[model samples]
Target chain A: MKYHLILRVVTRLLVGPILLYGLYVQFHGDFGPGGGFQAGVIFAVAFILYGIVFGLRDLRNRFPDRVIHQLFALGVLIYAGTGFVSVFLGANFLDYNVLAEKGYEGQHLGIIAVELGVGIAVFAVMLAIYYAFAARPPRIDDKDW
Target chain B: MELAITLFLFCAIVATAIAITTIRSLFAVVMLSGVISLLSALLFVLMDAVDVAFTEAAVGAGISTVLMLGTIALTSRTQKDIKRNNLIPLAVIILTGLVLIDGTLDMPSFGAPDSPAQTHVGAAYIARTADEIHIPNIVTAVLASYRGYDTLGEVTVVFTAGLGVVLLLGGMGARSRKRRQEEEG
Candidate 1:
């Protein structure tokens, strides 16, 4: 319907900007009011909006179920990998100081990296869930030969 | 100013709780619960617990609402009427409220700089964190470094919940395909 098209266009315009702002919040959270979790929700909201307007089927086709599953696993892996890397470097687990040959800068870098991982994982899992719930299975018609 | 904010928060909490308990529609109750969580987060911020507020706002208000709605979609929207009186639940809630008020009688005054929470290891952490971790936000330093183990546990809990959802609601495609084959045979 005409209303649906309007919603789609509006959502398309909104999603991109919201997603960008989410990334900005994720990175700048060290000095801001937001952080990894807030960024994750904002990122997820973009896709939720897309699913609402364009239909969950189209959104799923764009992201796909398998890719989302992988992203979920990959996010956790990135977080755990950062901790493991710290252990390997002779510091305790999640010891960001061991991340680089230098000192405090390494810790900062490590935190940012881990935050990014959490954001990505949370965003993907949330979107996958929303899509899974909203999507309806196709129906077959008896007249379809 | 702070006292007024605290009063506002207390009023909001009571209002939300009443709304949640009395609302007949499940969706309205869920949304009101979210409002309660958000107000509690603001109260946390007023208490100078920014990190806790952040987590609460994100998890309690945002994700919990979404998850609850998903569960609602999978279940009944309205509760079945019961023949019995709901007096027992009402009595239990009243008893709980009385016990909590009694407990608060022995608690530290709000915003007291020398409260036990502020005097304990928390003070040391705040005082030494700048030199020790060099991070401006002591909350971040505490979360990502000093008590990183707890953060790890929190992450694991989230991951487990994600797994639980997948187990409960996922893999539908495979099951549906199998059902189709059985019907054909």
Candidate 2:
């Protein structure tokens, strides 16, 4: 089925702004109503809209399977690595105070790093789910008997 | 102002729940379920449980709905008629609902500042968080630092779930390959 040009254009315009807004939420989460999880979902929604419009095959082509898998692992590593750094710094896991040893600015930096990790993990997992379902072959029984 | 928004959110939650349960089509049910989750997240916000709401809105409304729809696409959408009655499950649900209502009768009122949850650890966390952690978003500070172990376990659970999916799908493929080889031989 052919998608309407107007609908596609509108989706593109809205998605771009929504994704940017998600990033803003991620960065400004320290003083706002949103955090990593909300930002991640907002980001995922943008790509999901793209998949809905352009079809799953095109989405897969745009973001290959290997890249998504690596991103999934990388996000976890980033989160875990932050915690590991704390351990090396003679502090407990995820100890933000051990980050800069300066002041509140260091804490803000740590929170941003962790939030970004969470956002990336969520975004990759969401896309992975979409790719899995969208790429599945139609059941033989679904065909005309 | 928040109270007005809370009332509207409650109504939205109830409406979404009704819409989800009453829908006949499986796909429609899945989509409506997502809406129900989103509404619940809004309700959580009104309750000042922003962190819980964030997780709910993301995992419940987003990923869970997509997974359910994907499974439905693999299976038949039509609900099969059960020859036997579903009296037992229905009775259990009704009884559970009754128990919940009974329990709530003795519980604290909504947004009671002096409630137990908001008194001890909650108050301590709120008070000392800024001095100890220096993080503006108290939720992240609590989850990642104060309760770091719990967060680690949560991440492990997610990783295990992903591994389980890979194993199950791999097994299915291996079985199919073995069968094909036997047929060829």
Candidate 3:
């Protein structure tokens, strides 16, 4: 489908900022409203926007399915790894206190790590689902809608 | 003023939800659902649930809309008129709603100081988060540090869901090959 010139241009301009904002939300989540889930969705939005404007082919080339599949599992591993590490440090499972000498610092580190895991997993899943749906041929024409 | 805003947002949400159900065009339905999500996000903000609001806006309005659009692209644009009876489903829904309403009637009023929710660990979490977690946001402290196990479980759930979708969608190669053969055959 041929997209409008304005959409194409605007999407190009917007994708970078959207991605930056997603990262900002992910990192600043501790002090602010957003956390991993929200940031991940926002991050997925940038790619989704790119796919919509420039075509899914362009998006798939830049972000191949293989990498997405790996990231999907890797994210969960990161979260679980943090817990296992805490356990190895003579603490209970997912006990962030053992992460650092100072309890609060450990909590801070654990939160960042866990939130990253959540963000990455959510981001990949959203894109993966989008790819799955868009990969199929449309039964109806765009004009019909 | 808060009450007025809450009422207005609720009205918008109800109208959008009704419109979504009544609309035959899948595209319009998707748009209306997004509107409902955005309105709900606004309501969440009014109730001082900013994190929930952020999530609703991003997931509900943003990603879900895009996913629904992709679904419409793959499937039919307009819903089919089915002759199947929905009476049983309607009755089931009404019964569930009535049960839920009855349950709520027994609960404490909103923000009651002595309520079970407010009394049990809530005060301790709020009081200790500053000293223990040193985080200004108590929600973050609880979610990340205190309740890390729960968050890990949530991530695992998301991971499991992603795995299911990948398998259901036929990974990559098999799906495309099947599609090509279908197009050619």
Which candidate's TM-score is highest? 3
Stretch of 10 with least lDDT, candidate 1 chain A: A136-145
Residue A64's C-alpha lDDT in candidate 3? 90
Q: What interface RMSD do all candidates show, one decimal each?
A: 3.8, 3.4, 1.2
Local accuracy of candidate 3 as per-residue lDDT tens digits, B1-185: 88888888898888888677768988888989898888899899998899999899888988888878877777678889878788998899899999999999989986578999888798899999998888787787888778888888888888788778777766584457577799999
**Candidate 2: residue A48 lDDT (0-100):** 82
Measured with DockQ on alpha carbons, how good is candidate 1? 0.30
Worst 10 residues of 3 chain B by lDDT: B168-177
Every model's DockQ, to 2 decimals? 0.30, 0.30, 0.77
lDDT of 1 by residue, B1-185 (tens): 98898899989899889877666777788888998999999998997777678768877887678767766666656566657778998899899999999999999887788888878999988897767666677766676667766766666666666666665655333455477779999
lDDT of 2 by residue, B14-43 (tens): 887767654667777888888888888888
Candidate with top DockQ is 3
Candidate 1 at A88: error in angstroms?
A: 1.4
* Each model's lDDT: 0.74, 0.73, 0.86
Q: After superposition, how far is residue B31 of candidate 1 from its true place, in Å?
A: 2.7
Model 3 RMSD vs true structure: 2.2
> Which window of ten consecutive residues has the lowest lDDT sum in model 3 chain A?
A136-145
Models 1 onward score TM values of 0.86, 0.82, 0.92
